[model samples]
Target chain A: MSSPVNPDFLILAVQFVVAFAIAIVSLVGYRMFGSRTLFRMALSFFLIGGGILVQDAGNIATELAGFGPELSILGLVLEALGYFVLAISHIYTVRSEVGAEVSSMTLLLPFFAAAVQPSTALVLEGVARSVSFFLLLYILSENIIFLVKNRNAEALLPIVGFALLLASLFIRLFFVLPTETSDLVDLLKLAGFLILSGPVLVLLVRLRGGPP
Target chain B: MMIVSDILKVVKEEGSKGEGARISSLLRKANLPYNRLTEITDRMVSNGLLEVTPQERGSIYRITPKGEEVLDSLIKFEEFAKAFGLRL
Candidate 1:
């Protein structure tokens, strides 16, 4: 008999698809614009996709092959790295002086990661979670400042999206909600991803006017 | 990006039937300084976004199909960024 499907897989897979599409567009945008911000965006999205892929793989392997959660931990590590890449690169691009930030991240992330872990993977995952939470907060603030200065209505979409992502991360990192509530959190994160994908989605549609 | 797209648009508009647009005409219409124009065109040529044909004292430029695609993509990209209130 065929085994039952994991409903969670569908959500995670959709996340991976969205993240991968963004990564591809960012890669094209980076090539076209030759901008550091675009490069950072592409790299971060790729990392997000990687994290999702690894996390999904771990789940499947555990169910089918009876493997451990090490792979999932690695996914968390990658997810955290992705979030940091976006935050740090944005700061470096805009400010051009990133030494202090780098030094602090280097010193602090390891300690944070060490807080709860029996193995290397778990340690890395812990660090990753901490890094994701803090970096997301940092990025969200930057978006808010941009919105304040520009007062551009369109900018609010990303701001709201980033805020939702931060909230979801906060909940995931701190609180263990019930199963039904966890699904709601997943939907919240998915909505955030969709909002951030807005610009690229429109671009893709506009790009269709060109000759094939 | 807009400037580059403008250059491509000019070449595509003026260059047709294999005649190609002369450097002088491109310079006049594109409104870019001589050095900047040549630099941009040369890069475009190297990138295969524009084709250069030799003429007396200078070369004519024509936008390739790739150039058209890039121009279209860049235009869409600019609009996309603007929609998000992002500066490219």
Candidate 2:
């Protein structure tokens, strides 16, 4: 007598859970290390996780279905800001100050793009692609270095996942609104995030004081 | 912060003995330069994570209880970072 489960909602659930889990662990990293890098990363993950749900809000909630375009745009903005923070975390070089300058400088752009002008959505989308692509590349480079130094075959998971995500980003530069292209992007990111989560699981255990 | 944790770890390891650890010995064990060690030590002393006892030869450093707590957090964080394929 039970109805079938919706796969979209299921995927959204998994993404939400994983993103928030990583965000929580990274927040703990910020607390322990007192580094702006971890703080920004935590903020980015939180935004990305929340953005996933909000972007698909219409899909999940029947009443909100009519607000799809606006909600989706807002979600994109949130996700874009998430990418912005993530890229800043990777590339930011200023260390040892109170971090007021860094915080003010890095966070302003996404807030404006997200809140000020709807017309900027395209720009915001493009910027999101750039930042996330760069972020993946940076992490991939770090992963490669780690592998070379430690001979860790484990590093390949995130590397491959990030590579797929990177390829999707590259594809997006050409086909922005194609249904199949977006679907491929979604598939790649899901696979990427799942694989990347394996490494983060170790971090989560360390953060929680469990045996690693 | 990583340096602070590293210094605390070294001090705790080396200075847990009588009268704590001397600066020269700390320099050798901590792998940090002299001026940097002293500067960070001074700050750690001020922050209450470390305490100093003045002696005729020089000041000796020891880890405080607060330093132990901070060291725990920092070590866990460092391990987490390592797991995530980072040096810091």
Candidate 3:
């Protein structure tokens, strides 16, 4: 008899497709705009998407080939690193006195923490993801206030986009949805990214008319 | 440091009057010295972000369509920066 298809795999496939789309849009915008901010945003999306792909691959391997759990942990680590890179990008853009004094130990702390306690790797990964989400929320909130104070209408799009993302993250962190409805969170995340992608793509279309 | 976005803003605002701005007016509005404005405008012209018209009095600078597009992008960039509490 043929084996039943795993629903988790289907959900993962959807996530991969959405994440890849976001990464492509970000990268294209970066290439068209040629700005350091766009470059960092592109890198952040690419790394995050790549991390998801790695996790999906690990899941398939484990389910089909009985692979060890290390691959899964490694995937989580990659995702965490992607989030960290995103936070760093925000810091680079906002801070004027950025120093090249990053410590090796600081870089390795997450990996070491995961390695020393493999069982808690998932928790550690969750913590890292939460940190990124919180940072994003803080940034978005600040921007929303500034836009409000300045009376800029352009703020609406990003405000809606980031709000959806923040809601999704909040749901993921605090509430456990029923197993059958869990994919709702992923769908919400996808919607948030789609919202964010729209403006970037519009900008890309405008930029393409100009000299490269 | 003055970013390209800020420079583009000055050009776009100056060109908004539709008559095209003179070099002196651009320098005054952009808060850039003569040398810096000249250099930036030259680069912008080469990048297709600005167009230059030589007149009997002096050179006139106007923002091209591409320049407007860049200004739009810069506005978005400013929004992005503000999200991080940075003023661009």
Q: Pick the candidate with the highest DockQ.
A: 2
The true-versus-predicted C-alpha distance at residue A88 of model 3, in Å, is 3.3
Q: Quick one: best lDDT, which candidate?
A: 1
Q: Please say which candidate is ahead in DockQ: 2 or 3.
A: 2
Q: What ranges in model 3 sit over 4 Å off?
A: A1-7, A97-178, A181-191, A198-212, B1-9, B12-18, B53-58, B64-88
Rank the models by DockQ, top first: 2, 1, 3
- Candidate 2, which segments miss by more than 4 Å at Cα? A1-5, A58-64, A93-131, A142-157, A171-185, A207-212, B16-20, B25-39, B46-48, B64-66, B82-88
True contacts kept of 3: 0.09
Error of 2 at A145 (Å): 4.4
Stronger candidate by TM-score (2 vs 3): 2
Off by over 4 Å in 1: A1-4, A97-124, A210-212, B1-72, B78-88
DockQ of candidate 3 is 0.22
All predictions: root-mean-square deviation over Cα? 5.9, 5.2, 5.2
Q: lDDT of all predictions, in order shown?
A: 0.75, 0.68, 0.63
Interface RMSD of each: 4.4, 3.5, 5.3
lDDT for position B63 in model 1: 90
True contacts kept of each: 0.31, 0.29, 0.09
TM-score of 3: 0.69
